[model samples]
Target: MFQQFRYFKPIITISLIMLISGLIISCGSTSSIPIPATPTKEVEVAVVPPPTPTTPAVPTSVPAILAPDDSCVNCHSDEVQLLLTSATEEVEVELSEGEG
Candidate 1:
């Protein structure tokens, strides 16, 4: 009989442990101490006026040209133009080849 129920021992132990834990968790202390409410005094606060907003200085005009010493203008201007030209040529060749 013990040999036949040996496999069920761990399951039964775990179930019993879970059942006791659930009962212990459900039987928590319900009694709470009553807290006395503190009396609040009326506080006098000085009202402050909102500060006036000042207008930000607007730029009269934006310069059309970038600064001459700008590195991006120097480095990318020619490379970007070359890339655009090559891409345009590729599209033109593809169009011509398709037509022919």
Candidate 2:
């Protein structure tokens, strides 16, 4: 029994050491190799190009009337109103010489 115990002790110690080493190696980072302290160099800023003159700026004297919506309701306001109230609905207001 003593002889068996002596022979098995060294084998158990060696097996435990191998298991721990294998576990540590497997758990370590697969992507990177760890290197000691080194400072990185700074990059210089690049100069931007100035804007070139092309088209003239539009005058504010001109009354810029922007169209209302994305749809045709901007130009046809009367048609939109008529469509909203069914086909039979009548509008009594009389239009002036140039108006609809």
Candidate 3:
């Protein structure tokens, strides 16, 4: 019984020391650590009114109508110009131009 008491007493003392240290360590950490502040429910939101719809200004001059004969030129002018520019870069061509 005396031998058992000697072994058990050391184990009990170590366990108690460990438990007390753990509690003390936890308390110290909790005090040092920053807890986030709760957010306020009353937020100041800017209530923006929708933009007032303004009428577009009337045209000062009449717009020109597309010529019926030159429908292809009117529609594909940009594409035609791009193709011509690329083609000219590759090969030199002499042009007898009546109109641009």
Tell me the lDDT of model 2 at 21: 96
C-alpha lDDT of residue 73 in model 3: 57
Greater lDDT among 1 and 3 belongs to 3
**Overall lDDT per candidate, in order of appearance:** 0.69, 0.72, 0.74
For residue 53, model 1's alpha carbon misses the true position, in angstroms, by 75
Q: TM-score each candidate.
A: 0.28, 0.29, 0.32
Per TM-score, the best of the predicted structures is: 3
Candidate 3: list runs displaced more than 4 Å: 31-37, 41-100
lDDT of 3 by residue, 1-100 (tens): 9999998998999999999999889888966778898887897889655555675555555446745565665546788666765543566686777876
RMSD to native, candidate 3? 18.4
Candidate with better TM-score, 1 vs 2: 2
Q: lDDT score of model 2?
A: 0.72
The alpha-carbon RMSD values of the candidates against the true structure, listed in the order shown, are 18.6, 18.5, 18.4
Which lDDT tens digits does candidate 1 get at residues 14-54? 99999999777766634453556788988989865445477
lDDT of 2 by residue, 16-81 (tens): 999999888877956465666688768877754454476555544644566444576654678767
User: Which candidate number would show the highest lDDT if scored against the true structure?
Assistant: 3
Ranking by lDDT: 3, 2, 1
Question: Candidate 1: worst 10 consecutive residues by lDDT?
Answer: 87-96
